[model samples]
Target: MGTTQLETVPEPKYWHLRTVLSNALDSEFEVGEILPNERELAARFGVARATLRQALEQLELEGRLQRRRGVGTTVAPPRVGVEVNPTRHSWPGAPGDAWQTEGCAEDVPPAVVGRALGRGDEKVYTVHRVRTVHGQPVATELLYVPPASVPGLSGIAGLETDAGVARGRAVLRELQRLELGGQERTVELGSARAEDAKRLDRLPGAPVLVLTTRYLAAGGTAAVAVSTYRADTCRLTFGESAGTGLLAAG
Candidate 1:
């Protein structure tokens, strides 16, 4: 009789450490509880400091841990849920909007953004916006609008010179003048760009949730907005019922 031999699966050390730490987090650690220093943790787990760090990195990416430069690592609190529903069509600057205008610039967008806007080589108006909750910055947005789409913006004040927050507001106000037919939104995983990282107070190449929205009008694509939310701090919810968890947490 021939016996069948089972193949043994080999698991990476960091992966096994991650599992152990995850269990510890669930059964022992409380939210905001400071974790032991890396050296101690490495020694306790009998692994290299780099391996322990790898486990912590995975936990942080999953929103289970938080690390600050000066402050040590701690168990992260639950992520804040932000809603993005489409029951009604409204411009970004509409009443009760959570974003704040930061600045505006007229320049050729990056190739990816220009491709999405269906305009290559032509200049577009870029507006910078930031969103916060509990005074902590959670997301940074870049809204692109072609000149032909917002013809009346030329008459708006401060667009040519300062391009400050006032100009951003003026551009949005002019954008709302057009009739919005519909909009499309998509979410994907992405790395933080340098400028976006500075805005979100994170290191370059940090994990982020990228949301791309395209606003349509009778003419065609009127605007395109790309919002980068800190994946470690945000849990995006959709629909009216999305507010339930947020309200309870608050």
Candidate 2:
């Protein structure tokens, strides 16, 4: 019996390192599991620290690695899809299901929000949240709702947990009571704020996708939620499937 020697193939330093790390993560890591520090990992890979850091940065943008401050880098999970579907009106939860809520004093809203709400300097409920993916922060969302539009809401009842989805559910529970009429959405380029950048582990002023939508209920404007999702690591899915019409040209 004899053994045959196999040929070895190599690519760019960073590319090979990235592949090695990505495969290791897929096979050996669980969501929220932190990887060894850069210095250690680079030493293990026999590559320069800069090369390893570049690879890690790419993986992080791809939603595979999560970098934290003071803490360390960890494996990031897949991004959750929170759709803005016309078919569904509310989320899964009780009247009070959000992670937490604060009674924001009434104040004048931004110009864009005022137009969406179709009111002038009206008081509204402002809710903010930091959504995490794979235990790493990803995005920040702000929800502004006119108090009069959401009737019978004495307080934010179910928002206390650290879970962002729970908080969204709580808001939906309160929102469902009003008849959902129509809605509008817009997408624009935005720079990350200091707070959001801190959570997302990106430099301040990093590019992001800003989705501003107004929720209309009971033939009147209810609230507007401005959600900022990382453009590099996120995809927005909207509308129905695309199909060729019978009358269309091939």
Candidate 3:
């Protein structure tokens, strides 16, 4: 590979190094290829290890690289395009949904969810799900359903066994029985919580995209879903029939 020595520039040295490294990534690296260690990278670029670390962190945040726990930093795959607008809207767990049911339990939802459901301080059936692409987990979802929304669901005693998974499916089935209404959704940038970070194989406080959806039925909010997606590996797209192509981050 060719080396480009840094010249005096107005920008910070680390910032200039980040741009050089990014150009190298585009010209020389393939997806899933491990990058050189910090020492080698710093030496190659004629920069200190601290400067290299800053550049690597910036690249990782920009979705051009991934730093795994046991694995070294590698070129990340193109960001998965997640459609935020569909031509047809359906309930969660509907046919062809990418998320897999993990478990379910009765718990008090957060105050925001309670406000959306108009049920304050009441226990609701919370279903946990993980969304994967090409066998890699990319997002985690928590769906909260008030008892009044799924009155027919029963026999869910625990959330740590096979029965728990079955109960989760049952809750989804019961949810489908409701008359189709409408839904509202909002997306925001956030830091991954500890539990979500564990599920996504990221450090605590990693950047994430939080999507909140409120499903309406029977003249009230029937369910609320909060999905946390890895900002580095997923890009939310808006439009029906939008292709799954990663857009360049500005």
Q: Give TM-scores for every candidate, taking all chains together and pairing residue i with residue i.
A: 0.72, 0.71, 0.84
Poorest stretch of ten by lDDT in candidate 1: 1-10
lDDT of each: 0.81, 0.63, 0.84
Which residue window of length 10 is worst by lDDT in model 3?
Answer: 154-163
Deviating ranges (above 4 Å) for candidate 2: 1-11, 82-87, 91-103, 133-135, 151-174, 198-202, 239-250
lDDT of 1 at 224: 94
List RMSD in Å for every model shown.
7.5, 7.9, 3.1
Using TM-score as the yardstick, the better of models 1 and 2 is 1
Q: What is the lDDT of candidate 1?
A: 0.81
Minimum summed lDDT over a 10-residue window in model 2 is located at 241-250
Ranking by TM-score: 3, 1, 2
Question: How well is each residue in 1-250 modelled by candidate 1, as lDDT tens digits?
Answer: 1111122326777777877788788778877788999988877777789978998998887878878667799777667665566556688898867899999988898898888778997889999999875555779998999987788988865568867898888889989999999888888989999998988879999999998889999857889999998878877778766554343221
Global Cα lDDT for candidate 3 = 0.84
- Candidate number with the higher lDDT (1 or 3): 3
For model 3, name the residue pairs that clash: none
